[model samples]
Target: MTGDTQSWRRAAPASPVTLDDVARRAGVSLATASRALGEHPHVAAATRARVREAAEALDYVASPEAARLAGGPTGRVAVLVPHPSRWFFGELIEGLEAALRAADLDLVLFRVGGPEERAAFFDRLPARRKVDAVVVLAVAVDDAEHARLASLGVDVVVAGGRVAPYPSVGIDDHGAGRQAMDHLLHLGHRRIGLIAVDDDARASAWRTALADAGIEPEDELATTVAWGGEGGAEGMARLLGLRTPPTAVFAHDDETALGAIRTLRRAGLRVPEDLSVIGVDDHPLAALTDLTTVAQPVREQGRRAGELVAAALRGDLQEPLAEVLPTRLVLRGTTSPPGAPR
Candidate 1:
């Protein structure tokens, strides 16, 4: 019971649906019937339709667990994430909850995962035994770790970043990163700086995006660590202390952006005059702070992930599919041309 654990476990069967019964009526292979019901990628549309037609004729019904045995399903799903405190997490939870509720299944939530705890999670195969699948949100894990998840036979879907052998759902982080940097560049910010999380996967992607944009050629790229505010403030302080300090800054997230803004103001700098700033995430605070940002479709991402999970649960789709949501630019008071004399 790690992430989003909910009620309705071991509930009495809602109705009974038999794969064998469907297969026999459809005159397809039993395995084909399973794939058709699960909507797996390899199964042909024609065969799937024929199988569904057979199933409808039989008035088939099934328990979640039973269907998983014959298809790619489990009665419960686990939503694994880092950083339990944030508006983003809340939005993600809403989508996951809605999906599970509709399917009459359970959702488990696990947060603040470490190597040992993660190992325990895999060993338990909770997602396989107690849940049908898992959704990982903006959390960092390696290819090896993802392989471990695959070995456990739990359907996995990631909402941020990417993992091997697992279909993912996310907006283009690189495009998002470029958008952030491009905003600063457009404002005539040659001395732009970055405040990023210390995640290898995410870090590499963001940095590459900045490089490709031809904004910061080499020494201009300064790296600093922060997943949220405190780290962001420290990073900003360091950047500001440089002899040729950046005139504009982009924090990886809203919290980090706010931190940079705070650090600059404390150093007797006038925002948008002495300093221009931007960040991703139009967190509620962004409007309050008047910070310009690129807003990802957060709740919408959650809703889509939820719907995808639900589709797999309801035998509507086969195998996990990757999805890309969009991001929007929200202009506010924080950004301006660098060194616009106040």
Candidate 2:
């Protein structure tokens, strides 16, 4: 007792401050303090400030692994696209990455396509416990696959197509299809051809639009093609060989539309003169080709989807939010009143 109790204590080995200590000091629940530190939106401003002050005072540091184990957001997002090589998916991913980076989140890419790959992906559900949320791009899955996807228990925001129980941000497919067809139909073209991706949701919308206009797309004028420039060229070739060729064409996308234009030129026909053309998606090359199109905010759709996921992570958006963005019809050199001077 005489030899200075201070020296005998040896500072009692300074204890590492834990989240529990911060919560105790802030007079809040452990969960509230955790949310405050994680910058979750559900925590009140005053509570967050108090929690932060307590953390600083206690020199408390949160373990990334521990936080995740405790049901906290992992600050990572997963993007599932049918084909990363495709222009639409590639551009969508770019927008999603930009938005995620701005929020200090990481992105994980999963390219799923074809029956085999999709089946395997849904079976594994690899994203479980790996990411905070998932963003699905334009890949339609059957009911069974949808059920499998939902079993992953991750918040999802879709970019191109709608899946139930999850919020989506995309153009209205029906409206977009009608806009494209109306442009061609109003241009005084009755015999209109359709070059669209086979089994795509847009195809159904296009059919409905054509039916509403009392223009039944006959077998000769309707061709279901694969998704790109090659398909466009091939589809156009088949349509041209028909006994009653169409004076105008409505391609599902701008890439296909551009391909159609090339085919028409190769046949020594002038665009909007020998035939009028219209398409969806104001793609990057649309301006160069002067392609008339229904312009949707493709990039914005991805960015907004990212924001929605981030909000979900912060516990700000509990209820599902479905957003259908607007699309505008852009007129250009590719389309005009049929039979206009070359």
Candidate 3:
């Protein structure tokens, strides 16, 4: 009985071992094999030879999919952006396209704006085994979104939000927070207020305390708003109604900042005199309002993300890390030393 059992185990099935199977046999990784055979000039030649031998003995053929990307074939990279016309997403896509073109990779742009389109995207993906990888730019996705992407069994990198188990690229939103707050502190603003984005109040609080900057917002100092200009105006209106209003304000983004300006001016408050204001995102509209901001290098961050993703695609990148970029404080006419609230 023992002899038969051992013999049967030894005489395994004739089906070809996959890349996963070969990695296990070689005491390396699927990534290692791809690095050994592909364009990873950094891998040791001896290591490459070992992988090749194990691959040969197992009669393992490279996945047609891997060859298209990891190898020398013309491959496609799918880039998913939530919306197309938004400035941040548009700049990110431009950077992604620049990188892909440099590598002669095909770029498939998809705008998964709503429920129906997202469903169609995922449904069409299973058959797109030939596609190399995916890039999610600035789209805060839920678990269901991630699960669908994982089901496709392809390399993935997310930009702008922290999607776990996948490498991500973003500015220290918290640092951008600190920078924004620092500007206010330098302007002698103690009675400051905030127009927050969405319902993520913790993010708002954390950003204030980040990098050891800004006033800890009192209950009367900070207010939550929606994601756009209306939210900004509404939050500012609430701040103005308080017994002691803020001398200055910071909004979540440029759009919100503009709304804050509208509210302040309509209330007979003077900019930089009665109520100084600022925001994040150096969006084009921000300039038209002459708003101060923590200017993020949107396109540069996108380019860096592209480079990081490319390194992952080549199998030469092993260390898992969060890449953080820098942001700057851009001063305009809107911000000044805090004065008496009007």
Candidate 4:
């Protein structure tokens, strides 16, 4: 209270205002003050307003580290990939990493390839508070899995395929399939077989296209197999053994198409000469092997999904984004008019 003592106290620099000071001023717990400042949705509007006013009065600037410890963004994203070794997933990861790195976020990968792995991942993710967001890469999440993801209380994004109730970026599978099926239909082929990895939108496109073209879709002409060259080979063999074999075949992807071509070679039937073939996803080997396919912007899908995650984190995204990039048919030596002379 003395004049000299007051003068010395005024001369000393003021202590930086802490979150505790704001909490005391707002008559709330320290955790509540932190949640309000962190923009956690569970805080009441009135409590958040009171905390903001207290922070402003005290000139409290939240440290990034403090905010992170108080349940804010961890600056990391978890990417769930079904097949990490595949080229498609590799391209998606490359694009996603670039975009996330630009946004100053780290990418963590989790492989959920099979039923047991997926179940374990879903079960374990909610128990940990490691990532601020999750990106699912070409994996179909079931209802139970979706519920588990929701329990994480973080943004969820889908890339390379569509998943309902979440932001997503990918090409239209049915549209891409239509492009492939229509190409073969245009090339003077009436009996076109489908070699499918799954009975998804692409398989539906094949059936619809054939029906629209006034050709009955035969069950024997359409075969389901695993994903990859070996599966394609098996499906093609089944088609070839049919009483009335198709003049052209549409494989699920370029790799599968290549496998189908290999089967034809083994059977002494030349590609596009004895039977035409087409596929989706213009994988790098597709061009090298001269396989015709529907080219999708696979990497772009990943990049866009990363951008979506960034926007959602910044609270800039107004709504859940469902972006569908375009796909185009790429012609190559594998496809031609049915039975055209070699």
Every model's TM-score: 0.75, 0.77, 0.80, 0.81
Give model 2's TM-score versus the native structure. Answer: 0.77
Regions of model 4 farther than 4 Å from truth:
1-36, 39-70
Write down the lDDT of every candidate, Cα atoms only: 0.71, 0.78, 0.74, 0.87
- Residues 128-196 of candidate 4 have per-residue lDDT tens digits of 868878999988888989888866757789999889978899999999999999999999899999999
Which residue pairs collide, candidate 4?
Answer: none
Candidate 3 local Cα displacement, residue 241, angstroms: 2.4
1-342: candidate 3 lDDT, tens digit per residue: 999999999997877567777666766545556656675553556666777888888888888765543454336778888788877888888877787777666778888888888878877886655566788887777788777776555567777656676778877776786677778877777777878885453246434563355345486677888777888999999999999998888788888888988988898889988888889989998888788998888887677667766665555455556777778889998988876443
What candidate 1 gets wrong by more than 4 Å, as runs, is 1-74, 126-128, 140-148, 199-216
Which has the better TM-score: candidate 1, or candidate 3? 3
Regions more than 4 Å wrong, model 3: 1-18, 21-74, 199-202, 205-216, 340-342
lDDT of 1 by residue, 34-146 (tens): 65777655456777888889988878875565366455534667888776577788877777677667766577887745677667766666344556667887776677666
Backbone clash count, each prediction separately:
16, 0, 0, 0
Q: What is the lDDT of residue 222 in candidate 1?
A: 62
Write model 2 residue lDDT over 247-272, tens digit each, in one string.
99989899888888888889998988
Evaluate residue 139 in candidate 1 and report its C-alpha lDDT on the 0 to 100 scale: 71
- Please give the range of 10 consecutive residues that has the lowest summed lDDT in model 4: 312-321
**Candidate 3 C-alpha error for residue 40, in Å:** 12
